[model samples]
Target: MPLILFNKPFQVLCQFTPQEGRESLADYLSIPGIYPAGRLDADSEGLMLLTDDGKLQHKIAHPDHKEAKTYLVQVDGAIDAAALARLQAPLDLGDFVTKPSKAVRIAEPDWLWPRNPPIRERADKPTSWVAITLEEGKNRQVRRMTAAVGFPTLRLVRSSIGPFSLATHPLMPGDFIEVPANAIHK
Candidate 1:
């Protein structure tokens, strides 16, 4: 079977196994044997790939592959040039130093769905959207990066992984479609 492009919703666990009071992939996916190639935290949302092929899974999940993962982030405060520069520069995250990433201010995505609980907005503080691309995955990296720079991430969505993108294969939350593994590498 080919890989699956899943639009993972916020608060959904990456694994298929049941968790106490947490929604898992098994709740949405009935297909057997397929598993997520990479993880997206329950607090985050967007495109994720599931496959049964071990080689393809490794290619997608391995840090050595340096697959570009893109995120649409909504932050608690307006991001200034300095913050953008910090985001684009190598970040020291205590345990590891992150590679330089692409960070740019972006207008709110019109195509995005309204997050179920919605991000909390402060009446006095302004919020901004940023498009950030990371070459490597880290535990809560984007959230930590933004907070480290003084602007905490309020909402995060993974819009792409490697060559696969939500734009190329549009899926609403909880929807998925099958695609050839070769298409992901192309």
Candidate 2:
């Protein structure tokens, strides 16, 4: 099985196909017969897994499998204990209620790379960092969750999926490495 770990940069579409004047995965990767196991939106920067194995792809991407994905978020306001509690509890998202998730305030990671078009800054307001681990990957779920809690996310980065993580195998944007398929078992 060919398993690839890719660091997706901001503004790149998650698909391999060409889009109208926007960059896609095809611009960064030309490997044939492999597709993204899960998608990260064009606005979110993060780690993405791609593979040729259909079964493995389904197992990784399907919400029923409950694969844990960790994200480092920069929100617009200074996070507080009450906000963290609400994030950890089951909160209604209007369309659907989210499952209880792991959320904690964290210091901004020192190793994070600067985004090309930096997030807007306001001198009057403050921004804080949070680490959130979710079992399901709903569309724009992280952004919605933060916004619901009164801390709109300014920047988002997926730091890990299941057993693989950028903390252990750091890759720059648009860079990729084929890891052993068996590494997923650990």
Candidate 3:
């Protein structure tokens, strides 16, 4: 079983196919026959898992499996306790209601790498960090949730998916590590 852990950079598409004027996984991944288990929008960055095994891919990506994915998010303004409560509550995203998730303010992770073309700095409003862990992978869910709660997400980074974490692998942007399929334990 070929399982790869990739550190996806901001603005890089999740798929391997080349996109016009945009970077794709192919730009960083040269391995053949592997596909992303879940997608991270081009604007988001961090842990991405790829595999050749169809079963493992589905297990990792399918919402029904309820595999938790953790994110480190930077919001435009300071987040208050009320905002945290709203975020923790089930959120209706119009399309679907998100399952209850854990959201709490956390110090900026010291191990995080600075994103390229760094997130725009606003002198008027101070930014704060939050850790959000969700079991479902919705389209730009973290960004949407933060905005809905009145603090727009300025930067989003997925730090872990289930038991697989960027910290364990310590991969830099565009770097990857192949591991045995059994290495990931729920």
Model 1 lDDT per residue over 139-166, tens place: 8999999998989999999999988889
Error of 2 at 19 (Å): 0.7
Q: Which runs in model 1 stand beyond 4 Å of their true positions?
A: none
Between prediction 2 and prediction 3, which has the larger TM-score?
2
Go through the candidates in order and give each one's C-alpha lDDT.
0.92, 0.93, 0.91
Task: Tell me how many clashing residue pairs each candidate has.
Answer: 0, 0, 0
Best prediction by TM-score:
2
Give model 1's TM-score versus the native structure: 0.97
Task: Report the lDDT tens digits of candidate 2 across residue range 28-118.
Answer: 9988999999999999998999999988899899888857999999999899999999999987899999999999999999888999899
Stretches of model 2 off by over 4 angstroms after superposition = none
Cα shift from native, residue 123, model 2 (Å): 1.1
TM-scores for all candidates?
0.97, 0.98, 0.97
Ranking by TM-score: 2, 1, 3
Least accurate 10 contiguous residues by lDDT in model 2: 177-186
Better candidate by lDDT, 2 or 3: 2
